[model samples]
Target: MSQTSHFTKVNRRDLLSAGAALIGAAATGLAFEPKASAEKPSTGATHTEPSATAPNYAPPIVQIQGGQLRGYRDGKTTVFLGIPYATAERFELPKPVPPWQGIKSAQSWGPVCPIPPMAHVGIDEFVFPHRYWVEDEHCQILNIWTQSTSASAKKPVMVWLHGGGFTNGSAMEAYAYDGKNLSEFGDVVVVSLNHRLNILGTLDLSAYGPEYAQSRYTGTADILAALQWVQANIAQFGGDPGSVTLFGQSGGGSKAARMLHTPSAKGLFHKVVTQSGGGEVLADQDPAALLKIQQQIAAQTLANLNLTGSDISKLKTIPYLDLITAGQAALRSVAQANNQRAGWNVIADDNYILRQFCDWSSDIPQMSGSVFSEMSSNYVKSIDKNSWTPQQVNEHLTAEFGDKKDAIAAAFKTSFPRKQVQDVLFFARPNTRALAAKAQAGHASVYNYLFVYEYPVNGGTTSFHTAEIAFVFHNLTEPQVRVATGDASEGYALQDKVSRAWINFAYTGNPSQPGLDWKPFSDADPQTMVFDTVSECRNIHAKELIALLPPPPAPRF
Candidate 1:
């Protein structure tokens, strides 16, 4: 690994400016990359960024494991997009990219793994805008943002895994997924990748052939391949391959935690953070039985396609949509028969992943958290939570929670004394205590957070799903961010605190900073960072509330 000789310092103001450029580019739906440059980089030198008010086209080029490639510049951070990390056939292990004859143009995005056609953008985009690309099966690609392309500038690498369960979503799906700002903010190399998803990556074809021998998780395999690529080439992109932090939200969080139980991913990452998605998946049942059910689903998928074991080769050429639709139908049939919900689940047949992520001992510092409002009472449409009369609160809570409404209301009042009675309808559920305890038992320190910041939209959505992403990315300058959090100076200050906490966590194991002193969470002292204008550590009421209601529904993709 190369050593750092010259450093380009990025202070908080510079960080904020870098992040501001990111969202505007994302909001306009334009690719943030510029034309590739053929110029080679100086080994070690003080590199200054161009002014943000103008577009400075100082494209950067670097040599990596595959070969020489080129990237572009956006103010302080340099960027490279659509770099092919690996390639794989339908339901096969990822194969590393071969050495190329010449420089590959990484200015544009590569094809995304094929998923069901997405519906038109809804109101959700108002909170989290998106970027779309064409789809393909061989979609093993990665993107990079860094302070320099010099081999000697070894910055920390933060790899992001995207959400959409194991079924949908790509690295470039969300505007907030942009990395240039975060890279500058933390002075680290930011990476995000595109991997296989849904049935194409999880079909249990191993029973019919040896190539598919691993228990149904080729989607995660694609991610593992991306990590391997980072280990081999990130240093050339000014990243410290050994100092990697795997972080993601929703399904992406589960993906990051999944790496904890994966033996192969052991040295690829040094730390992890999961937002709003952790401990939802665990392998506590018999591994053999899990594999058995998976194989049954695979067989049914074959039957739906009118193919037999001898005709397994036909799967490669089948239309992508026809294949996925049939696979989903087969999964539903099998899951329903077993009195289980339909979804593709990997068996713990692989010894490396025998239980929930982080259930075993390790020094790896981890953070897990969720928003206060994963589901809004606005979904009910019958009650105006913002203007509920005292009688309405009583009548509505009774209808929503039945006879336990009184108990739930009291618990809500005790937990959130300042919040309105209607807020209980959307606050976070008590679900992470078990995971915290499990990790603590193994001697691992885990930090928890609850984002209750209210967005300005709809008289204050308070805290909807994915509300914290922009704040954590320090992307409040985006017009959409203004729509979500309003033009409050406090929003800027909150972004600084939140984004800094994440950056500090990436550098050290702990997220504590000068302003906010965060603490690790465990069952004995369930301390949580309740993020808002007045953020503080407190014991929560979600546990008391959970006892008053029925079990929460299974996750949806």
Candidate 2:
């Protein structure tokens, strides 16, 4: 374990300048506006705005025989954004997006991928900075936040995938995905992308007919195509294509896990970071089940719309939003009949995503873990406050555990004696235990952490699952958003520490490069880094919890 001395200090001036380079002359795209009160966070580092006009902003053209992408200079670095990697006919499957004649401005964020509207949601699940109306099917766009416009910069590159449970999310939605702070701090290029999701991406319709077969894993396919684009053109944006790292949280982590085992994704990315959102490999279920669901939905759509053969094509031609509404209704019917969870999950596919991914390959480095008691906060808020009681807890436990009630209750009792049996059993204990076991079992170098910084915004409990995201992006003090934890100097330092560790991991395969002595997962010793007022990387007892559940049965032939 190295000490913290190896971590480099990031100049605030460089980060602000990199952020300013994202806007352009185009009115419809990103427009840089300086904030009035730039009172820096109590860290003593003040905010400095970029120069309105950078006379020395010498940008370069990335010459692709078939494609054109924009790039520009910033304080000895170059940045590119919104470069099209592939095109889709109807946002279902990705194909080669036709090349442009002149240089396409990769200056602003791209159009958002198609997803359910988030404006009316009560459960505050997904969060990002920019949200755009879905305007076209060619939503397979990728952005580059780089350090240099020239190939000579050759910095490590990181590609981020936003998570929304594969149902409702856009890469453009959260402000934390910004590359300025990270790119400047680590001297790396960062990319965030948009791709097909939900019914638009995964409907398992392919088992239904020829049209449907192309629909399954479309989101994963979109990601592969984006990686292909990175391999060919990231150098133009001053990035090292060979050193690309794929990272995401929540739903995005779920996707990255699947990609780890995917044949199509082989050799596309060298490193992976799974933050608080992985290890729930799908339980064995009938493959034919999805096809059946799709067929039932198709039938329902035709009947409800009162349409014959001629109207069927019109149904397909209807806007993406209308199709989404019809799909939601169809899914509701299936869920009612089968008792499905609210969000459709990443299914194991023999063709696209192999079951081998679940087996834990040792070839790569994996960072996997969860927030402390992630599901509890949501569980507490979901139940009717007036009707909440111990009896209600018992009833809920019985409903969830069924025949396994004794086992579940006993496990919860031992793990969280101070808390209610229902909260601990149903939410926190199972998840954290599950994640740690899965990551440890894999052959790859594994790093685990528990995010426990409780935010005052969430009534002063340790951090929640998604709370670490914005802070990891170095956006904790932004006025538009509040950190779930209180505004304290310790909290800020923890943010910097964790975020730096992430950047360090992107730069090198290990989280502790020059500064910290971070240890990877081993069969003999399972260590986890605990993030709180003071961070410590050490091991805790997990064997008892793991023994509570039988080993996951081998995958069926």
Top candidate when judged by TM-score against the true structure: 1
In model 1, the runs with Cα more than 4 Å from the true position are 1-58, 119-123, 281-283, 356-361, 376-383, 553-557
lDDT of each: 0.78, 0.65
Please write out the lDDT profile of model 2 over residues 351-407, one tens digit for every residue: 666655534344667776677656455434544322458787777767765777767
Candidate 1: C-alpha lDDT: 0.78
lDDT of 1 by residue, 29-134 (tens): 9777754797656688677887665543535678887787888777787789999998777788888888898888888777787776666665566666777777
Best by lDDT: 1
Candidate 1 lDDT trough over 10 residues, lowest sum: 1-10
**Model 2 TM-score on a 0 to 1 scale:** 0.74
**CA shift of 142, model 1, Å:** 0.8
